[model samples]
Target: MLASTTTTTQISSPPQQKFSLWSPPNPSTFYCSSQLLSKPNKHSQKLQYTERILDQATNILSVLYPTSTKTFSNKPLASLKTFIRDFLKKSKTTFSTLQLALLYLVNLKKSFQNLSFLQENIQLLSDPIFKCGRRMFLASLVIASKVVLEPAPKNIAWSKLSGLPITEINNAERLLLSALNYRVVLPFEEFVEWNILLHSPTVELFQKINLVLKKEIWEGKSNEEDGPHYFVHYQGWKEKWDEWVPESRGLKMTEENLKKQKDLVAAHTTKKPEKKSEATAPSSERGKKRKSEHVDTVDEFAKRVEIKIPIPEELKIKLVDDWETVTKNQRLVSLPRDPTVTQILQKYREHIINNPTSFNEKEGLKSSVFQEEIVEQVTDGLKLYFDKALGNILLYRFERFQYVQLKEKLNNENNGSNNGTEKLGEATHAEKCMSDYYGAEHLLRLFVQLPSLIAHTNMETDAVNVLKDHFALFLQWMVENADELFLKEYEHASAQYLVDAKNCTS
Candidate 1:
């Protein structure tokens, strides 16, 4: 096998963007807050206004978007006016002055009934990745309208209104979602918050906020309008909109491309210039050489590779309590594009743990039946069975481990996460998600789930017994509750062989 000399290097560094909304407006700008220090009357106007302002001003705007980052860069009012002009010239989305003013009052309630308990609180956005601006607000409006409106306009329709391409619009939506790492989801509370932000203010004759984009005049698409209009409304008007995406998302010539790639890989992995004389030899005679050449070529890019060692029929390796055959198959794998093999492994693992594929139900239970075994009372025979069982389990589990670790790393390289922000040719293929499969917290929970299957390789003793018991019950539940294709089949196959390690059932 050829040596693995794969290497990669990172050549660029850029400053990161910090999350920010709009800075506060006036010195006496009353920011809302749900003061936790002192108990406040639930029905008071202070509570409503405080929660409303903070909810919007803060990055956790669940009333609008479920996942919003913490940012101080809010200009929704100005953006709102701009948006209304461009899209809702005749639509009912425009709000009247009285209605809008009432909304401001609700959003900015003066402390009444409990003036002594008034507290100044602000939760500035702290995410280091989210940068909210006009584009973000416009995107939010398009998304939130789907939640609030009975019949929302299609995405493409908003493209003309917002002066953005559908792809750009979708990219903006995706960016907002990814940045909103930590968010608050108070359904009922958010309802009240949104109400107050609109027109449910407890105060009367309050001044309406001038919903103007700072440093910008209205560029709304309108032909009929009076001078200095305060309100904009949308009548019941609809237009035909097409939602067709550009060409095919995937290349139609995949088979041809795949074959070419495989051939290239074969050539690279087997580059030893074996004499041409052997090419004329019988196929059986050249099999070993071809296999060796293939391994040699791929080894250049592989971190590790496993090949099963052929065992003679007369010689069997197993434990005294085992009854199986076929043994010793393992190896390693990595990539040449990363700076180090370790970095490649990390990326591979991330792809596998994150990318989920649909498993076929028929394949799930194909290996459920026990492997054929020879019943031999001799001590050596039992020992051979044990070794074989262990080897089979280890080989099967390791193979699965490799696949699950590098699953999505196999995707076409063109589809990357840095969609909207990429410069002319500065494309990137970055990890888009990191989900903790913890489904757990605290020390006790860690002990409960026991992490992935790799952790149970040499497991035994009381802990092993506990895991077996848990496994049996869980397996029973799965065979009862889970869809056939949903459960990971490899895990089950490995577990069955491990259970047969003692050959008790055999």
Candidate 2:
């Protein structure tokens, strides 16, 4: 009886185990399964995420780095996984896991900004980034730490923590600031959204992170009522566009339309005498000269610019066909690319109501009803818009709409907790970006830098004719992989553009 009682008691109360590699880590301890699963935290994710991004950033190292990945081995975080794992185990009280993740993302962005500077520089021949993978990530963390912490440690001290040389850190910092267009302190809401992919969603970590960062960010909520917003700069693009959009737009003068217009003019018009300048020829002769000059200019621009965009053949076949479906009654507007799809749809809806057509639907101009072909044709440089118009259409249509969608998603998600205090800073910023994008001056520069965006995306080829083709492969991937992060950043950029435009105007 005594032996049976002792055995039962012992079985009921199991032995406690501490930090076992094979067994349940703490068998005797009662822990919520949630806490156990969330134990392994951000460092692992940081190492993995940053490693992937580094590979993308350093593929064209010749343009920015002294050497390629083949010539370099990243050693700063040689035991990166082990180090992170050990740190987590040992320093539960000392370190904030959320802070660590945030720092990693900031570092990643820093690395991206560095690459962008080199990619955009007209004179710089070598890519400034020599090493990637573990080295770039660790360096970025150190760099981010300096920016985040009050009275940041010196290079020597950072070297001790990260095991990187003071000199390397110094060199990296210089390249980091060379372009100096990067932001160290991004808005907390954006910061949270940007870092989401760095780890699995853990509400507990998020709550802790907000506290650590000393910001009230949660569930993509920014508690600030009137925080600064970022957007795309229009730089008075609307007013400047008002000047040229109608005048410079290429007329949709198909042979049939041209001939019809010619017949109408012939039926209505009477000949009138006209005067000519001493330098100018007769009206007939002058028209021929001007036509020749315009053709030469178009040819020269095509040859000199050498834009080539890629597309699946299906999109091409659908363009004219799809366009006809949208405009059964009237002619193709040949509107300048300056107009948004929203704008285009709005006008079409108004026309349908005023004219009362039952062509597609009773109430028409639905975005979903219109095929993706419309987006492809407008953005990828098809029949209607010029090469420059592709960029404008891109700015107005695809990019801006992504922002609108993201803002809506966030607003909906936060409906319960929004408390009517959160302002959609994104809307204000996007408006500014659209309004303030530097109009006339940056057009050519935008073109020159565009090819690099293509080249860096593993599409290493020159744009020969259609400028939009260069962006097609990249844009397609972007749409296919459109996640929360992608839209968030796009919204952020649009907002920044607005702020920049305002600043320039001020």
Candidate 3:
């Protein structure tokens, strides 16, 4: 659903408060004015710096590496521990930690960049950075807190390393929660898992291709007309460059792999019988049969048959109804039938006759049945009339009449009822009946309207609600039968037009 555009007023915080902490200043305002401003290309430059670090690590790994075999003489368990410890010390970071930090920073930076763009265009302030930064510190600490809890122990603790006061940290954490709208779980791993399950080589290949395309864009080697790059460049060595070769070469490679696999399978499986049986056939029939069999085999080999199941009639109708309901709810149809139009008009006329104080000659002009000459004269004579006086008069009159009718019905029901429960049940049944009657009447009225007689009416709120209900049913019917109806109308119109054109020419 589209977000509602209704504006709501929020009570301002008291003046004694230190800051309107909820309304954080825009990040662009801070980032543009900060020390980071010195490096206009900080994002791309940072990526480059990270890439260099990764390259150095990869180079170290390529060298003589201590493994389980080297660490212990045939002691598999001890050697495995030693291998892991040696690997971590040599790499300068645990693989898991490194992966987590890189993924987190990459995703965070992308999100912040998007937020910055939105802030720039819309001029909306984001959740305060003190909130986000503090949250990040807290989250990192939460993960580390599980392992390290000594008062003054080990490597830099989160609070001390963050350089923020405990109160500020707490406040920042709160801000982060608000900024994120309270969603703390990240779905990076889930996204990868889903991608793997999709099992579409095209999607994976496209991702690799997108990475290279983005790199080309970053290096200023991309064609302007090619279009915007969708992928972000990673701060590491490229992978799958060979697979992204030109389409013709790629297809050739794919075909070659398929042929090799086919050959391998063929080597294992026995061939089918090449000849047909000739038990009861004559010499001439045998020659003809062999030719026919050859043709049949060729036809079968050439055919590319695919099986398709037809959708059931009931399911098709249901799908159409659901689609139409959604579309009608979005107000993508014509003006809905409103039974309240006549009701409201009648009530307004009644009010004008009864309430002399509220009604004047000008208000009487609003009656649709009034003569144009009389309406003009009344409007000319009356002074206190507004443009929307007709609408307001109708609404007030209808509401007044509705209240009176409801009161009368309640009074009658109260006299008949022995208990509240019986009265409530009767009222509910009456309401349901009234709703059904109104819906049916509206539908009947809609179906009877000729195209030439179609008219627009300003419906009251209650009338609009009722009309929407009937409109919903009509939309459901249209969804189920619109295709058949449209085709019939189209053919009829075409034939009629052709006949008319011929008659005119003759």
User: How many residue pairs collide in each prediction?
Assistant: 41, 38, 0
Best by lDDT: 2
Which should have the higher TM-score, number 1 or number 2?
A: 2
Worst 10 residues of 3 by lDDT: 25-34
- Regions of model 3 farther than 4 Å from truth: 1-156, 161-177, 186-506
Please report how far candidate 3 places residue 20 from its true position, in Å: 42
- Find the candidate with the highest TM-score and give its number: 2
Query: Model 1, poorest ten-residue lDDT window?
Result: 19-28
TM for candidate 1 is 0.20
Report lDDT (CA) for all predictions: 0.28, 0.32, 0.29
Report how far residue 226 has shifted in candidate 3, in Å. Answer: 7.9
Residue-level lDDT of model 1, residues 1-506, one tens digit each, is: 11122211111221221100101011101111111112334234323332333223321121112223332233233333233333333222312211222232222222211234223212212322123344545545544444334455555665656655666665554443333321211132222223333321211111122232211112344234422221211211221221212213222222244467568879868856566786547864688886654343223212211112222222121110011211122222222111222232233234323331312132232221111110011111212222222211222222333333333442223244543454211224352211111100111111121221112122223333333333332233223332321211112234653444323211
Model 2, which residues run further than 4 Å from truth?
A: 1-80, 83-119, 122-130, 179-182, 201-506
Model 3 C-alpha lDDT per residue in residues 395-459, reported as the tens digit of each score: 11112233234445654665455444542213343332122112222222222221101111111
Candidate ranking under TM-score, highest first, comes to 2, 3, 1
Compute the lDDT for candidate 1.
Answer: 0.28
